[model samples]
Target: MRIVVLAGGIGGARFLRGLKQAAPDAEITVVGNTGDDIHLFGLKVCPDLDTVMYTLGGGIDEEKGWGRTGETWSVKEELAAYGVGPDWFGLGDRDFATHIVRTQMLAAGYPLSAVTEALCARWRPGVRLIPMSDDRVETHVLIDSPDGSGRKAVHFQEYWVRHRASMPAHAVLPVGADRAAPAPGVLEAIGAADVVLFPPSNPVVSIGTILAVPGIREAIADAAVPVVGLSPVVGGAPVRGMADKVLAAVGVESTAAAVARHYGSGLLDGWLVDTADAASAAEVEEAGIRCRAVPLMMTDTDATARMAQEALDLAEEVRA
Candidate 1:
């Protein structure tokens, strides 16, 4: 089986782990979100791609669900001591090496996809992990200043990592996405995949950002395979991250049914909601997408694998 997944950071990475366990023989291709990419201290950081790579490669800090395990923060501490900082992002010593390598390769004229491939050569993430676009497409959040001076746009990292997404966002857009193309193999993978999945990642910033790439969404919508999604929102709340805040900015309710509708029946063939939100299933189905309710918690590998199996089952149903 060929599986294509549009992935974000932690949630998406965890789901991919389960998917790998559930379908060990499947050829999985991940289109990682790059909208969260930011340049910090003259280095390029691709958070989503690194999260997925670390998680799959057995280097992830299991508890935090991001960053390398057994990490030290000497570099971060050194930077802090210098008093030159956006100390909000805790880039550790081990993590700095990744940014250094990526930035160096990028300066040498390699596109993001090639750089990612080189990085993955060490991680061996199992799947073919590719960025959504080699071109720069940053996600920026528009928010009112704390002092009420005026509205201004902030990088996604600043808004999320620094402000902790506490500010009410007026809007979120993938800056430069209007001209970005899908990274090499992204569209081809979608075209050849037997199934496409939208993991329970942040809808607005993760999967939404990937879809923001010019032709990626249209390719998935046009693909012959079934396109299915697992809900990140359970009973009117996100399982992780401040997804509700961004969902609200997009004018979508923080509900499973609403999120499914946000993706729309035209793009999604099937949708999965948690058993707790089973009532929302009918509403989602009524939106012209097939919907089912199952246990959506990723409590452990077994539980997450079960969820992955359920998604594949739903894809088969849609195919039938």
Candidate 2:
């Protein structure tokens, strides 16, 4: 089986792990969200791509669900001692190596797709991970200016990581997405996929950003295979991250049925809601999407794998 997954950061990475366990023999192609990419201290940082790589590569900090495990803070301490700003975003010593190598390669004129392939060679993430676009398509959030003035745009990282999503967002924009083309092999993977999946990642910023790329959404919508999604909002709230805040910014309610409708029946053929949200399944199905209520928590590998299996089963049903 050939599976194509549009993934964000932690949630997406964790779900990919389960997907791998559920379909060990399947060929998986991940179209990672690059809208979260940011340049920090002269280094390129692809958070979503690196998160998926680290999680699948066995280097992820299991507790935090992001960053390198057993990581030291010497580099972060040194930078702090220098009185450099932006201390809110932590970058450990081990994680700095990745950014430095990536920045170096990018300076050498390699596109993001090539650089990602080069990085994955060492990690061997067991899937073909491609960025949504080689061109920089940063996710920016529009919020009221600091002193309660007019509106201003801030980088998604600054809004989410620094401000902790406390500031009310008026809009979310994937800057440069209008002109960005899908990364090499992204369209091909979707075109050739037997099944396409949208994991329980941040709908507005992560998977939404990937779909913001010019041809990605159209490719998936027009694909011959079934496209399915697992809800990030389990019980009228996000299971992780401040997805509700962004979802609100996008004018979508924070509910399983609402999210399924946000994706729409035209794009998504099947939807999965948590057992806690069993009642929402009917509403989702009523919207022309095949909805199934199942256990959606990623409490452990076994539980997550079960969710993955359920998703694949729904895909088969949709195909039938």
Candidate 3:
């Protein structure tokens, strides 16, 4: 089977690991969200892409579900001692090497897609991971400035990593997605896929931002395969992160049914919600999406794989 997955950060990375276990023989292509990419200290950082790669390659910090395993913080400590910092965003010594190599390759004029491929050669993440767009598409959040000043736009990293999404966001926009084209294999993978899935990643800034790219959303909608999604919101709250804050920014309620509707029946053929949200299944189906209530938590690889299997089963049902 050929499957395409649109993924972002920790939730997405962990889901991909489960998907791999569920379909070991399947050819998986992950279209990673580059909207989370940021340049820090003159080095480019692709957080979502690295998370997926690291998780799949068995290099992920199991406890944190992101970053390198057994990571050290010497470089971060040294930078702090210099008193030059946005110390809130933690990038450890081991993680710095990734940024350094990525920045160096980018400076040599290799597009991000090529650089990612080179890096993955070492990790052998098992799936073909492609950025949503090779062009920069930094997500920014509009929020009130500190000291009760007027509203201002901040990088998504600042709003997410620094403030921890504490402030009310007026809007979330992907700065350069308007002109960005899909990375080399993104469209092709979607076109050739047997199934496509949106994992339980943050809807607004993760999957939503990847869909913001010019052609990706259209490609998935028009593809012959069944496009399914697992709701990130269970009952009335996110499984992880501050997805509710960002979801509110887009005027979507933090509920399984609401999120399924947010994606819409036109794009999504099937939707999965947690058993905790079984009551919302009918509402999702009424909106023209095939809905099922299943266990959606990623408590462990085994549990997560069951969720993946449920998603694939729903896709096949839709296809039938």
Candidate 4:
């Protein structure tokens, strides 16, 4: 089967591992969100894409679910020693090599899509991981600073790593989204997919950012295949990450049903909610999409595989 999955960071990467286990022979294409990409120290760091690559390639810190395994921080420490700081975002020594290669290739005039392909050649993530767009589409969060100087926008990483999503966000902006074209294979992957899934990622900033790229949302909406999404919310809280805080920025309630409604039946054909939110299944179904209540926790590989299977099963049910 050909599966195309729209993904974010840690949560999406872990789920992709389970999806691989569930269907080892399946051809998987991951449309990774790049709105979290940041230019630091003259190198571009794509947090979400690198998260997926490292996690799947077995180079990832399984405990942190981001960055490299057996990592070191000499570079960061040295920079801090020099007072060159923004020390909030952690970048390990091993992970720095990735950004180095990516920056080098990009400086040589390669688009991000090509650079990603070259990078993946080394990792062999066992899936085709494509950025949502070659053009820059940075996600910025509008928040009030400590000085109460009214609302100001900061890079997504600053809001996430520094502030830890502590403040209320007035809006999440995907700068350059209006002019950004879908990366070369994104639309094609969606069109040719047997099943398309939105992993239980940060919907507003991750998957939402991917959709914000021109032509992506339209392609998914028009695709003939089933587009299923697993809810990141379980009992009104995110499985991991402060998704509720960002969701509030978009005026969307952090409920399974609300998330389903936010994606809407127009683009999503199926939705999966945790068994804990089974009561909301009826409302989700009434939204003109197939709904299922399943155990959606990713506590371990086995649990995540079951969740992946449930998403695929729901897709098949909806398609039938």
Return the lDDT, model 4, position 247.
97
C-alpha lDDT (0 to 100) for residue 103 of candidate 4: 97
Candidate lDDT scores, in order, read 0.96, 0.95, 0.94, 0.95
| Best-performing candidate as measured by lDDT | 1
Report the poorest 10 consecutive residues by lDDT, candidate 2. Answer: 84-93
Q: Lowest summed-lDDT stretch of 10 residues in model 3? A: 84-93
Every candidate's CA RMSD: 0.6, 0.6, 0.7, 0.7
Residue-level lDDT of model 1, residues 83-198, one tens digit each, is 97888897888899999999999999999999999999999999999999999999999999878899999999999999999989889989999999999999999999999999
Q: What TM-score does candidate 2 get on C-alpha atoms?
A: 0.99
Q: If scored against the real structure, what TM-score would every candidate get? A: 0.99, 0.99, 0.99, 0.99
lDDT accuracy of residue 228 in candidate 1: 96
Q: What's each prediction's clash count?
A: 0, 0, 0, 0
By lDDT, the better pick of 1 and 2 is: 1
Model 3 segments more than 4 A misplaced: none
Query: Which sections of candidate 2 miss by over 4 Å?
Result: none
- lDDT (tens digit, per residue) of candidate 3 on 245-267: 99999999999999999999889
Off by over 4 Å in 4: none
